[model samples]
Target: MFGIFIQHHVSKPNPPKKLLCNEGNLLSQIDGKGTVYTRVGGLSCNYDKGTLIISDKSNRVALNIE
Candidate 1:
């Protein structure tokens, strides 16, 4: 799956960040953890304590926003 994270700064606008994941099923959770599917594959994601985690079978990515 492909994920896009867009951050908008108060000073200006910037380009969005894109992430790609593979090999997972699409699922959604009410507790801030879920799997999203896109045209490419599936990605598992978690958001907790101002940090966001995105992963697949082969890769894991984390982003922190304040």
Candidate 2:
């Protein structure tokens, strides 16, 4: 599965969360407190190849290939 995961500013000791999907999707408006282990605003993904595209509030895209 492939997808991007973001951790928005939320209320400490935020546990790490992972999302895996066969298709691409977006998650937004997440509320939590500790340093975001991962923070993303947008993502593009292809699960079969384990490829992922992630972006931050600045809209910078990063690719993860596996």
Among all candidates shown, the one with the greatest TM-score: 1
Give lDDT: candidate 2, residue 22: 34
Clashing pairs in 2: 10-32, 10-33, 11-32, 11-33
Model 1 Cα lDDT, one tens digit per residue, 4-56: 32233333543333333223332332222354323323667666587667778
For residue 6, model 2's alpha carbon misses the true position, in angstroms, by 24
TM-score of each: 0.37, 0.28
Question: Candidates' lDDT values, in order?
Answer: 0.49, 0.42
Cα lDDT for residue 17, model 1?
38
Clashing pairs in 1: 1-41, 1-42
Can you give the lDDT of residue 26 in candidate 1?
27
**RMSD over all Cα atoms, model 1:** 12.7
Name model 1 segments beyond 4 Å from true: 1-40
